[model samples]
Target: MTAATQPRSVNSAAADDVAPIVQRLRETYARWTRRTPIEQMRDDWDELFRSRAQPWRINGFEAGGVAAEWIMAPDARANRTILYLHGGGFRMGSIDSHRDLMQRLSIAAGARVLGINYRLGPEHVFPAAVEDALSGYRWLLDSGVRSGSIAFAGDSAGGGLVLACMFAARAANLELPSAACLMSPWTDLAATGATFLSRADVDPLHQRPMILSMAKAYLGPSGNPLDPLASPLYGDLERLPPLLIQCGDCETILDDSVRLADRAAKAGVAAELEVYPSMIHVFQAYGELHAARQALASAGRFLGRYFTEQDKRPPEGRGDTRDCG
Candidate 1:
């Protein structure tokens, strides 16, 4: 679609608009994961993006018959908490790979983030991830953390989980967070987006057939891939908190975020969508990328509005220089 026709703004001259650093990132991801197996892909991710931040304490907890790592900022006693879910296509990724993003988010949101290391698929499949997410939220509530002060965030598959958790939470009559944010979220696990094929050549990380293979592995012989919990784009979107979604224009999964915004808007949920030109999937992982910095700054501004701070002024009071767009 042309930039003018799109629901949100787009830089059509993305080739020239994108920074050289992002170009290098595309090259790096292509070189690193070319023809690699899913397991090796996870290992490579660990080797490449592993956080060097000093290890902080995470109170271990059990939920839904699985163990989860809950990382808390040292000053969490006063600040609020965010429950973060890491994305790896339901078969990969861990809290360790997402540490940097979570740390940045914690600082931006003025809250301690609890990153959950949920169980993967091919062995645990479908409802397992959703069950773990609900269990984690329940644990947070049961532990005396006020629900209104908690926010949910995630990327890719984790993004889908955040929405699923919202669905489950509403069903159970739990209090919701003030707002939420998603980065390059894979809302449609069914891989039904036209971009999956249209942008195949440009998308660096994901390929349609390969992702379908992984989904099959996770679902096994008798699983429904289009189930709402698995593909939350197919689920109900009403009653969700205000949500901000950041996506890259060039990624194969771009349609996932687009469809989500459309669905959410149709359901009357407050949704703000931002699409960065010529950006790759989860480009925020490369902190040096200009688009990554822009996306993070956008997320920070959005969070700052919803997550009020005791000493800070309201977003409107902040100078216009901080505007994301």
Candidate 2:
């Protein structure tokens, strides 16, 4: 549970290294501003990143009276499947914005990743997203995929959803995944992390007040923002599968991942937490960035090891789950 050694800065000219991309992203945000309500931001993101290479088959499912798209990797036939949850502060984002990342993950895990376009908030709050995530998990299980062979992965809010699903599975006495991975999870939606203020200038994407507003919108009047299922860092972690968490040291949510790992370890869960230095929030979106590529490489390696181990382990009841647990 101790912190991994901080990665060295990739370049000395920090401003020169990030300014153009940041500026471009800012301009994109401005353009999004012109189109109000902000929920439509996912549409803009889907359009802007539409050219990214992600060849997948689309399937549909019903949740909360809404149809959700499941994007599955085309190459998958017999390999295991990963159910991916997309992150957008529980408000914006879709399967498309995360398509490239999930494609890489699908390739790395040697499995098809099914990315869910879950219901977002201010309209569908709290358990709405949680229920949709579980429904997606159930769909995978019902489709004949062994639960132990399946994995859950996500980034930011989706990362949080990953933990939520695991907790729900455990509570329901259902089978858990062989492994799970998260990228800078927003685990503590209550905005308890001090980094929100101290790291504001350095962290990109999440400005504290903005995230708080989104959190409030997602929680609604009946929900408790601190409920462990809502804010997973505060949840029980024992009996969970091997966990892989990756975070940028520069993000406001940095502490969320760090603390979650520490707590998971304390609760006897096997956890690996990697912190990439000087990277912004969900930097993996910038596949061209050096740090992003490195992070993905690390993720691929970790998943390869876990999947290989899973392949060796016999089925539960036939063999001890405790060894892998």
Candidate 3:
């Protein structure tokens, strides 16, 4: 093959390697969505997500006085911390289900990570998660961690909570964190995004019925999906910290990241969005995959930019940057 075609050929081979894994995941998602009970799903997740190796010295503690767990690598970086939120469509998910992902993130970012076990829906409802997220931030501040040294990160519904926390912090006049990173963020709880239908076939995990079900479970009869706190896509994004959003083109919520970046830019925040080809929602679950590993490393570097003391200048207008992988 000519030199010009070499890169394409290698990429093609790498993609082929990932195809079987994606197919297996898609099949598994379909099975779970069809037959799994909501309560049982938590246990199912615990069994499904097994860590290959432990990278952090894990411990449970009261973060800012709220029940939380901290995962720190052996040689952790100083003055850097990540407050992570786990995703389960607001109804499920816990620190246990997300430990592996958090461990990988801690290793990649070289920072201390706090995974807060926020209250879930069907019992706590809309503002409960919001309240917990804000409280976690408050605890972080009370613990003497400077806002500039911290970053907020999450996946799916937890990702939405990250944005909600930002809004809450801004309104409360709390100093904002240095940056934020969202993975396959379910920003629009209303399930109105075009990708919900367009990418339905490609995304094995989420479906219209399940998506709407989760929305109702979280919002209840009184909650409004358009409330910026609940659905951040409708929120004011002006003056927010720099944001990095990563999503797979095949995800049902792909537009959530896309429009979020656009809205953040229109409001003048430095936002970067990356759309990975042939990947599904939260593909970072497969740390073994080259694409997922690359995505996580990129995410680490993006958050690190803000954590670095020397790069704290105010972001400029319409930093609407996009990258493809």
Candidate 4:
């Protein structure tokens, strides 16, 4: 709900270390009570990125028929790429809003980051954003970026979008990326998880009405939430690449990642889920927070190893997972 609501207890001293920062984030989000128009929201999101000095270089790319940017840290490898999709409920986020986040992730994972500004909703609607993301993936492959060297990543809605792209890619007979790392993935568009109610008191960003509104706008009036393209949670998960999903323990969408992991594993996919204690949605976006740093580092290691092994080896550790609270 808000930072004023105390979080459910956790078992470790690390939670104690991260609790204050997490609470502060919640308080900040709680203060975001007023709703702005979509354009204002986009501007405001970019302002957060503009307020700070950039730690990496950013350049414009061909966009592959969709707006996109290329981000690289000093140590980023050209051959390795992370196809990044920004999360804004499929209606608002841009590459500018997620530039720094991509930079940090690129450095951590030792890969070049390609961030795309896919079509947003209430205008473009469902399948449009998904189509743009698929375009980005297709461009990467056509440009000679090895499918094994590519990994997909996104936060919140973007997280689910990347997964949806995987399903689309497979149906089109395109080689899937080596792996994916979803930050607080919004896998369930229907908002079916029990945590929507249980964690509502502690989660600062999401609530049912707002969630459903975003869903409706992205889906348009006629789109079905259960359509595999709209919500990968309902899709057949077999033969999809490995996945690493990270979500805050206090999120309303906590079970989105939880349920996705459970189903992915059952359907023969490698899905690892990490629930960060006391943190709110997309904690990795707050690079100043310790939990965010730890989470990104973990995701970096996860993707780095996979990037190296994707072309050279078999998926031997496909079902292994390391869970944390």
* lDDT against the true structure, each candidate: 0.73, 0.74, 0.79, 0.81
Candidate of highest lDDT: 4
Clashes of each: 0, 0, 0, 3
How large is the C-alpha RMSD of every model relative to the true structure? 6.9, 6.0, 8.4, 7.9
Candidate 3 or 2, higher TM-score: 3
Q: Against the hidden true structure, what lDDT does model 3 obtain? A: 0.79
TM-score of 4: 0.86
User: Each model's TM-score, in the order given?
Assistant: 0.81, 0.85, 0.86, 0.86
TM-score pick, better of 1 and 4: 4
Clashing pairs in 3: none
| Model 2 lDDT, full chain set | 0.74
Compared with the true structure, what per-residue lDDT tens digits does model 4 show for residues 53-119? 3855456755568877777677666667899998878877788888889988988997878888899
lDDT of 1 by residue, 1-325 (tens): 3232244644542333445645554564675444666677677666566754447654455543456555544443233667788888788888778887876676666666777778787668877888888888887787666776678889988988898888888889998877888988877767999999899987766799877877786666777888777778998888888888888878898888888888887787778888887777777776766667667777767865775354253322211111111
Which pairs clash (backbone N, Cα, C closer than 3 Å) in model 2?
none
Off by over 4 Å in 2: 1-16, 32-35, 55-77, 308-325
